[model samples]
Target: MLPAVAVAAVAAVAVAVAVAVPALRHRLVRSALRRAGGRYRRRLEALSSDVRLNQERRLRRLLRAGTGTGTGTAGGWEEFQQRHPLGQPCREEAPEDAVPPLWLWALLPGCWDCDPRLQGSLLYLDALGTAFPRALSRRGTALLHWTPGCPRAPAGWPLPTLYCTPAAAGTVPSRAAALRLQLLFALRQRELHVLEAGLAAELHDALVALRTEWPQLARELALGRLSPQPGLPEEVQRQLQALLAPDAARAAELRAECARGFEGILQRLWPQLEVVVVRMVHGSERLYCNSLLQAECQGLPFYCPFYQAAGALLGVNLWPAEPEPRFLLCPDWAFCEFLPCLANKEPQTVLLDELWEGREYRLVVTAQPGEYRCRTGEVLKVTGFHKQCPVVEPVRRESQTLSVRGEDIPEEQFCQSLCRTLRTWPGARLIDYACVESSLLGDFSGPCAPHYEVFMELQGLRDLSEGQRYKLDQCLQEDFPIYKSFRFKGSIGPLRLHLVRPGTFTRLREALGSPRPMPRVLHQEQLLQLVQGSIIS
Candidate 1:
């Protein structure tokens, strides 16, 4: 009986195992097939088909939307794939009816490695959407590349699409192109709201001021009469007329006053426009202008004081132009041609004995228009009809010395002393100087040489006189006599003074002694010059 029971139990266990093993294996096979098949393959295939269908429908819709049918649908599939290759379906956001109609498509090509200036301008455009909703609504959609190194479709791009080179993108030209596109779009769309009320008001005020100051020019412009150039817009023509009036006497007086006023205004506005102009021309705007004018003048002319003032405000030096010797009536196009030439000319000129102190002098060569100018009532002598003569001023030399100690002084203390000393010197007005650790000085373990060097730069000289140089020398000598040797070097007409040795703390204290109502004036007459002795020869 026990043996029978054991056999029956073993049979029962075998039967259960046979049933469970097959069921488990079947389940495992099914999971393995699913895993090997690819999780997203089916889904992606379905999505791709839907995307292709939608794209086909969109192409048809786009064709129907246009007044004329498209030429053909060749390469349509490839084009669609290029745009949406991943087969990702665009989300269906409400029906097309839910969104406003698109009036314009702002198609932008790849902007990889765009310039910072262009980026800033694009941001400005983005900001404009807030100010002018209609300008950037469904009517206008800014389309930029979603991926790097992808080119935008030329066909889908809105009319008057701005095609910028990868190199030019994020540059001044890009910004200018954007501005032009916006302006044109606004005009075409009849969306004047893009020009906010405040901006319009400001523009209106500017126009009014211009007209009031230049009534005759304004009248000519309004009348559509060509005061200078027939091709120029009347407003621009009027501006030119005001700038280059035929009446030499009146024009001179007006220009002088305008220059003074413009200078003041530019001091405030230059910061904004500098980047604007730079980006518009790419880096080549000035270069292009210079090339154009090279044949006519050796350099550009300093004709536009307004632009100069703007440059000043931006903290940039305007390209110096050749001065006009005797005023002559030239065509407007000639004037335009002259501007670029001056911008490319060298700013510094060596004074020859013949040219120095002469009432009329020739520029090193021909100059660009709106670039060269005589210092205060100075005149240029025109040798030929288009020749430019610049009034050369006497070359002035000024110097200053700074003393440094053999040991590196605390940065704060050094800065304070330097500032104090600079404030005292008349000719040595500080023009943005800084102190950085110099490897040369740091390596110099000598008793006299310091671990760091203090560099000083001066600008806006009242006059380059021997007296001024002497005064600067005396100030430095008296302040820090330890660093007796001084070295001077720099580009342009500005002077640089470097005291070679470590300055004494006590000497610096003496220089800063007592505060007075006004700082002591370092006069030109106070400088001492080093004389070469017979023994040296």
Candidate 2:
């Protein structure tokens, strides 16, 4: 009743002020709608946990017998897993098909939307068809065109071009196109339900591009700490300004909530630019890995389990209630929580049911159509669990972990150190980065000592001083105790950091195909040569 009375009072004030300030009336109404929608969505999320697993089961049934016949909801998953005890691991050798297992079906259920009931409202960085691995992919969007029950794309969201064009093949977007699309998506949040994009690296590029293209708006939203960037639609410019009020309290609040770095910049432009990063394992494109939500942004490639989108199903919200569970895996989609029978001979596998928090596991999937079992080279660590669904963090790719001299620093720790170093560097919006173990270097490249070679593509801070270069080495020491020990013992040499030419990664991505992502950990000499050639003085 108190809340209702307060809302009523606010409404009364808006009406009373409307007569004197007609222009501001629409603004107040629009703000009210966004707030009200937020409240409604939160209410839905609160109720989602109760029915999430049910919805997932419903989805799995629709995945077509891609997992094979004889599998039903009743203890069938256990039986199926026993029969296919082990499957082949993901390799560089390409498969005949790269589509999601669901592609076998004529039309993927439109429920991948926040809810099947809410039609034509989803807007992603790439069309679902365009998303590599194509989890829900094209058929999902095509349904919106054919079925009346399917939700239609909302006004001003650009579904046809954004969804169907040559641009649909995502992974790499040209700077100019990326900036325009990103700015458009940032403003569209006033109405849409969810806005999905690729990994953290790609999202950083978008945000950096956002600031580069619209300095004034970025400055005001970032509370002037970050330098200015330019160009935007007038209405969008007004909306972005509205996000940052002139009042001291609001400004202070913004400053306090946002400090420095991409994380801070993200907070400053949030709600309006709520971008979620989807991290799909590179080699195995058909399997959905996980996603990083706006709240859990760590400035790295990490995410909550893919099926946990229960908020969209049960609550229609981006966040979920406590004990956050994953929607049940399809009976057709078998998972392995078992340990590998061999040692370093095989990758580490996490025991899902008996998951020990902080321990890493190789995420395995049999979700692809006609595939027996494929051990995803991706590493996911158990963070927490909701009911039976495990909440996981994609730690790193198994092959990406630097193992020279047995220091074996995981990618996440390396990323954490890199991010920390970035915060201290001047004009840092780390666009794309790759790590190379000295082991990849040929005998002629110095003594071929064990160390790390890091290549970075940054938007600002043209060059680094000796001290700035040293910070990365210091940071890596902090992240990996063994690495520090190895350095101290002289077993490992110092880490080398390089600033690469702008568009180096872009050109590399183009060479790799628009749908393909650049490898984060460069193991091959060929890939290193391309990066080496692009390094700036």
TM-score of each: 0.21, 0.52
Candidate 2 structure quality by residue, lDDT tens digits, 233-322: 344344444443333443443344444434434435343322233333322221122222332343322222233111121111122222
TM-score: model 1 vs. ground truth: 0.21
Cα lDDT, all candidates: 0.26, 0.46
Off by over 4 Å in 1: 1-120, 126-254, 258-421, 424-428, 434-438, 441-449, 459-537
**Candidate 2 lDDT:** 0.46
Candidate 2: residue 536 Cα off by (Å): 1.9
User: Highest TM-score among the candidates is held by which one?
Assistant: 2
Tens digits of lDDT, candidate 1, 13-87 = 999999878656644533332232232223223323333343344344433333255542445534523532232
